[model samples]
Target: MKNNDMLKNILVWVVVATILMTVFNHFSTQGQSATSRLDYSDFIDQVHQGQVSQVIIEGQTIRGVYGSGQSFTTYNPGDPGLMGDLLDNRVKITAKPPEQQSVLMQIFISWFPMLLLIGVWIFFMRSMGGGVGGKGGPMSFGKSKARMMTEDQNKVTLDDVAGADEAKQEVGEIVDFLKDPTKYQNLGGSIPRGVLMVGPPGTGKTLLAKAIAGEAKVPFFTISGSDFVEMFVGVGASRVRDMFEQAKAHAPCIIFIDEIDAVGRSRGSGMGGGNDEREQTLNQMLVEMDGFEGNEGIIVIAATNRADVLDPALLRPGRFDRQVTVGLPDIRGREQILKVHMRKVPLAEDVRPSYIARGTPGFSGADLANLVNEAALFAARENDKLVTQKHFEKAKDKILMGVERKSMVMKESERRMTAYHEAGHAIVGYLVPEHDPVYKVSIMPRGRALGVTMYLPEEDSYSYSKRKLESQLSSLYGGRLAEEIIYGEDAVTTGASNDIERATAIARNMVTKWGLSDNLGPLLYEEEDRGGFMGSSRNANVSGEVSKKIDEEIRNLIDRNYERARQILVDNHDKLEIMTECLMKYETIDKYQVDRIMAGEEPGAPKDWIEPDDSIPPAPEVKSSLEEASEKPKEDLIEKDMSNDEVKEPGEPKLH
Candidate 1:
């Protein structure tokens, strides 16, 4: 087919070139001989004098050669005696009729440019595979954009996928059906028409689909849902039809649509009702899946993070028979995923996948792969032969807490204040009974924060308890309270804006959403907008009195926690100073040092710390306080916003 197209292109260029050459030769002046033009009287004088040896005439125009072998041309006057004079003078007259051109040739010459333009247009269109009404062209915009892969082309199998064992099992049956449909047919069973894999992004839903194709050894067709919809109204519907037709041709093939939510949103639920093109596309998809024309042996698998917003008809048993939830991996699943990715990297003896997985509780499969890649990069940057635990630790820190901003200079007083602020958060979290353990604290600037206090959960918890929530509330305000106690009321800065906001939100959720408040009496007051076109309706039903009570409860919760955090800081002022001084000296401290500080002892150096290699070039040393004080600061101080104080939900790590 490609050879034929190339041949056609070559033939077109030849034809165009031939036409251009013909036109050039027809009107070119290069063919004319060197001839001098003569006036009519001079031609007559020359003829009378016998200077023109020979003459040729066509109507009023004449051409002749003189005795001197010179050529000349002139327009003759309408004189009846000219022919006689030429004859009497022995001018050797040669007469011929006037030249005439055919009507067809004249017309062709006149319209040649337009014709050439049209030919070029057609050639370009054909070259782009977009000729008028041709397949896979602009005129045929309804054609499917799905990429097809034969059985042997896809290399990924189920073994390559990890972190979703249940999802894998659910899809294993699809593979079996594709491999041999008769097994289920003999048992009086029919395979599902469609399967929907719902999960957050990067959970390997698309990878699982490819694995199914590999395991079944069948053709695979993959496309994004957005590819179907276009500005034209019926284009999306047409594409859906064309896609299903393709799948039917390759029977027992799998069709995977990724990010289906783009076209599968619930009908009439968008901002101003719904998108016509998207709705039409969704409607066509529905009809193709479970319509009157049965698509036997063609399994449609779709993936989406926002499954809640999908239309109800699309989720019916006849259409999508199963919904596989490929959520974030737990510890065991994470370890498996890490091991799968780590197989490519050269790891040292201290590299433990399980330990890394435990530390990264809520990471997706893609995130784990990225973590492995980042660790390898760190090892390579240090000219190391193998990726070690230290490299992994640096990569993990970069991912969880933003990269360290060592170039950002800070004032001495501001540094002291940041140390106290982070110390306050650590001390309160340590004292709080139900809070997660404080993992690390730093006075050095990282990300947007001037300082950071990290907390690592002992284990993954699916839900948060009331005591834990209260402890979290206290810890959140710990930064602000510490600032106020140390600097006095008027001297406290706005660095605790994020802490105040987060603490308020936690207290509100406790009163309204969680119903932890005794005054709320286990009632749900908060109205959530759960994938709805119109905003939440529950809030409209609550009375003014109830709303006022909810606000009062939220305020009381915040006030109680605020006082609790303040009192803790006040009692442990000595411990706070010790922790702050350690932070000032080392710029960073781990959990053990924090424990020592809390025990009223001087914190020691980190035990597992690895010093920089002497062979590697070191960064320029930072100037001392005396040198910095003499010169103006090179950079402005970053705002002391506690926005990086990540107080996550139950499943996420609670890094403060």
Candidate 2:
């Protein structure tokens, strides 16, 4: 490297010197030509006329100053009378021999520029041909772009990762194989040549791969799938070969490829047959992974969110033998991830990881890390010494619902309408059987909405039952229904546009996808998939009459839910009004206040509300309603076990 840099420097200096010499030669030639040229006859005529003042004679050249003091030059014709003529004319005469340049020096001067240009061209060509270092040049295009980190460089062990315990355990055997390959070999067991980590983005797939490398104490080679491909044909294949060769050179090393879907998409499924470069790259990778020529000690780990798009051949037993799912963390996993990120922040005594985790269901590892960082920033903005629970609450709310649009001014009438709309959603969700609890409701503008009502599930739910989905559909219609009841149907605003769309989609899916409608039977009536490289295929073919019936079923489902929501709101109209009034006063209200309003009582002040300190003025607070109501007593609230029949009557509020 040092030699190459020194050579480059020397070349630069040589070019600079050549340019300077060329400029100097040009100026010197210009100075020599300052005297105008004169014909020999003209000079002789001038001397005879006594117009020449002085002359300097060389072997065949004469330079002289005319009577007017202008300098001129002429060539001599070897006339013997020239000297006598000059003497007779009384012109000042001096004679000397002509100066001669060596043949070699003249040739060197004449051809220097061409030689310099050729030398520069050759230097650039050599540089492009990877003459300096075997990286980044066109000649090195076939070389792998994978970055290698020695065992000592990677310090991310499994302990550093908190949410992806299952992924770690899945790859643990690979680490063992790297540590003691003989143990597996003795039992006629070969380690998996490739492991594919499948997950959504930011779920710690890359982190898990690094942890595996750390655990094995082996070299880690990392690259993106897109890096192998190029505009040129066959380059991707070459890169794949080169990458595998490098991994083989560093035996027992782990190679991690992120976003493999970029190059691993199913072949022959694209519009114009397929991408040749990408397909070739995927083919080479498949061969290198588990080919006839065994790569015994190399382990290839790849991560992708779109596993469905990958070539099926790549997922076969010999290639990627195992697939580890790095899914979003559950509640417990989220709590652990929160704790991991919380370690870097100065926390107040009120900062509880478990509580934050519960509020942030379905959060990935990266999301939790960001949450912790956001909380820290919130604390820093307030000039607080420690991150408090309120900070985390603000961060979570911002992430979930988007930043508050506090500066947005709404008319009092609109604000009142928003309050009623949100209150309707909260009340319907609270009363509906099999529905998640109404976590909070607010009339304050947030993101694109003038009001928001949030729901929180007590536990992580992987699937929804028919009852739960029906309840969700009903709750979705509650807002528009509330508007219709408060103001006549024609007075309803477009604020419930999103709610109508969601509710319609749910009802349609219930009929078409979920087969929840009795008329649809236990069959799917969904439209054909319009995504993916290959052409779409309809899941089920229905006659035109059946399609009409399907639409009818969807409409019936929506109507039923809409009426259910309307009836629920009408039955609790007084409670709804009370909740809306509370929302208008507070701008936001939590589940505790919601429960009090539903029970036909005033919400009053929050139990956890504290008097502001007189000595130190309070900074602006951005606490979420959930966090504000967390301290409220919950012993008397309605229990989850309450049956739907218990509150079927109008004006009867269900109590625990």
Local accuracy by lDDT, each model: 0.86, 0.84
lDDT of 1 by residue, 355-473 (tens): 89988878899999999999999999999999999999889888888889999988677887788889999999999988999988988788998889989887777899999999998
RMSD of each: 9.0, 10.4
Model 1 root mean square deviation, Cα atoms: 9.0
Q: Candidate 2: deviation at residue 637, Å?
A: 33
* Candidate 2: worst-modelled 10 consecutive residues by lDDT: 634-643
Displacement of residue 163 (Cα, Å) in model 1 is 0.5
What ranges in model 1 sit over 4 Å off? Answer: 1-115, 123-131, 134-136, 270-275, 531-540, 607-656
Q: Top lDDT: which candidate number? A: 1
Q: For candidate 2, give the lDDT of residue 4.
A: 94
Query: Which pairs of residues collide in model 1?
Result: none
Candidate 2 lDDT, 1-656, residue by residue in tens = 99997898798878778787876886485328446888898888889999999998887878899889988888888888988999999999898887787999788778877877886776776656655446666568788999999999999888888877778888889999999999999999998888999998899999999989998899999999999989887899999998889998999899999999998888987654554788878888888887789998999999998888888999999888799999999999999888888888899998888888888877888898999999999999999999999999889888887789989977667787798789889989999999998777878788988889999888999999989998998998899888777665645789888988888888877887877888778787876574734645354677998989988988888888889999998898888878888887778788788878778777985554554468976566565432233223323221212234243448777798
